[model samples]
Target: MKKKSNKQVLEMLRNMAEGLGQTFAPFCEVVVHDLSNPKNAIYAIENSLSGREVGQSVTELGLARIQDPEFPAVIANYANTFPDGRKVKSTSIGVKDDSGEYVAALCLNVDLTLFQSFQAAISQFTKIDEKEVHEHIEAGGNHSDRIHARIDDFAAARATTSRSLKPADRKQLVQELKKAGLLEVRRGAEIAAAHMGVSRATVYSDAK
Candidate 1:
C-alpha cells in the first residue's frame, strides 16, 4: 500500500463519488449493511434525491426480504430480474477485516426509473430531446422556453414584492416600480383612499 496525502485521499473520494454518480446514472447507488447482520445488505444509495427528499422505505425500495429470501441474496447477488422489473445494473463487494471475515456488504442503487420518467416528459415536450433536458425537474425549460421563463420567474406582483422586500430591497423595488411608472400610489392615504373605506384626510391623520 502507498502512503496517500490528505489532499490526494479527499480528491480520490470525490472522484469515486463522481464516477459512481455518473455510472449509476438515472438511478441511485449506495453502500450500507444491516446493523444486526453487518454482512447483510440493508440500505441503498439514492442519487435522485434533492433538497427536501427523504430516503425511501424498505418496502418502497423493495428491501424487505421474505422468510425464504434475504437482503444480501436479493440485491447483493441479483444479477438480473429485480422485482421492480427494471434492468438492474449492480454489484456488491464484501468488506472484510484482517481475519478475512465478512464485515459488511456495500450496496449500490441505480436510478433507471427517474430516467424513464424524464424520457416520458421529454416525449411529451416533443420539441426537445431527453439528453438536452435537466436531470432535475427544477431545471425544466428548453433554450427557447428559458428566455421567457426567466422573465416570468423574476416578475413579481407589487403587493407581494412590497410586503417581502427589506428596506434596501424595498427601495430597489420602489425604484423599479417608479421606472415602470407604477409608484404613483404610495402606501399611505392614496392606498387607503383606493380601498374606499376611509377618506384621504382620515388616512393622513391615521398615519400619525
Candidate 2:
C-alpha cells in the first residue's frame, strides 16, 4: 500500500478537527498539529476556545513527543488551565504514518468552567446550615382539636375521603392514630369510628 503524503494526512486531520469542533462547540477546541514543522505546528484549529490559531508553534508536550519515539499514542483527560484561569481538560493523540514516525497530532481541549459551577451548586445545596431555625408546636389545651387534626392529616396523606376509606385503610389509620397516642384520648375510638364510617370494634381490632 502506498503511504499517504503529509498533505493528505493534514487534510484527513482537518476534517476530523472540524467535525469534533462542531460537535462540542463553544466549550471545546480541536487542533491539528503538523509535527514535521515544529516551528509552526498548528496546521488547523476549530472551535478555538483558547484563542490559538493556525501557524502557531508546537506546545511543550508536542516538542517532547518529537524528541521521544516512545511517546504514548494517546494521552487523555489531562488537566490544563487557560490564560484567564478557567480550568480545562485535554486529550492528545499522536498520528503516525506507514513508517511509524509521529508526524502529526490531534488535541481536544474541553473547558470545565460550567461543570465546576454545577459542582459548586450541588455542594451548596446539600450543605446543612447550623444557624437554620427548627420549628416546634406549642403544647397547650385542645387535645380534641389536636386529635381531629391528626386524623385529617392521615386522611389527606392517603389522598382519599376519611368516610370513604375501606376496612383495610381504616385499620391502617387506626394503627397510625395509636402510634400518635390519639387512640388513648377519651372518646377517641368513637370519634375515629364515626369519621371513618367504621365500627368502634374495627378500630380497636386494628389497634391491637
Candidate 3:
C-alpha cells in the first residue's frame, strides 16, 4: 500500500475533527496532532474547549506516540479534568501511514461538567417530595472541594483510593490533568500537587 503523505493524512483528520466537533456541539473538543512535529503538533483544532490553539506543542502522550513504536494505537473513554475543576472523558486514535508508522492522532475530549450541571437542573425541576435526589454540582462554588473531587475521580478511574495511589499513578493523573488544561488554572498545580502528596516541581515535571 502506498503511504499517505503527512499533509494528506492531516487534512483528512482535520475534516473529521471539524465534522465531529460540529456534531457534538460545544461540549466536545477535537484536536489533530501531527506527531512528526512535536513542537507544533496541534495541526488543527475545532470547538476549542481547552484554550489551546493550533500550533500549540504536542502533549506528553503525543511525544510518546511519536517516539515509541509500541505505543497503543487507541485509547478510549479515559478520565480527564479541566483547570477549573471540570471533568472530561476522552479518546485518542492513532493515525498510521501505509508504512505502518504513526503520523498523526485524533483526540476527542468531552466536557462533562456542563452535563452534570444540566442533570442537576433537571433533577431539581422533576423531583418529588419523597424521591431521593443526588446533586452533582457542589454548593458555594468551592474551588477546594471541586479540586478534591477531581482528584478522587481520577483515583477512582484507576480502581484505587487517592491515598493509596502510587507515584507512577500520580504522574499519570497529572498528565491527564495537564492535557485537560487543569494545570493552567490559578493555583491548580499547587492543589493537585498537595492532593497527590508530591512537590509542586514534581507535578510540573510529571506533565513534561
Error (Å) of candidate 1 at residue 190 is 73
lDDT of 3 at 12: 93
Give TM-scores for every candidate, taking all chains together and pairing residue i with residue i. 0.28, 0.60, 0.57
lDDT of 1 by residue, 7-96 (tens): 343344345545776775545555444322323334334363321122333322233332223344334535342465665455554433
Clashes of 1: 10
Query: Candidate 1, overall lDDT?
Result: 0.40
lDDT of each: 0.40, 0.85, 0.85
Q: Give the TM-score of candidate 2.
A: 0.60
Give the alpha carbon lDDT tens digit for every residue of 74-181 in model 2: 999999987788899999999887777888999999999998899999999999878878643423236556766777777788887778776787777789899988
Task: Locate the minimum summed-lDDT window of 10 residues in model 3.
Answer: 135-144
Candidate 1 residue-wise lDDT at 122: 93
Tens-digit lDDT string for candidate 3 (1-208): 2434888889999999999999998999999999888899999999888888999999877888888868999999999876666899999999887767788999999999889999999999999787587554633235556667888998999898867788898888888888877777777888777777778998888889
Worst 10 residues of 1 by lDDT: 50-59
> Each candidate: how many clashes?
10, 0, 1
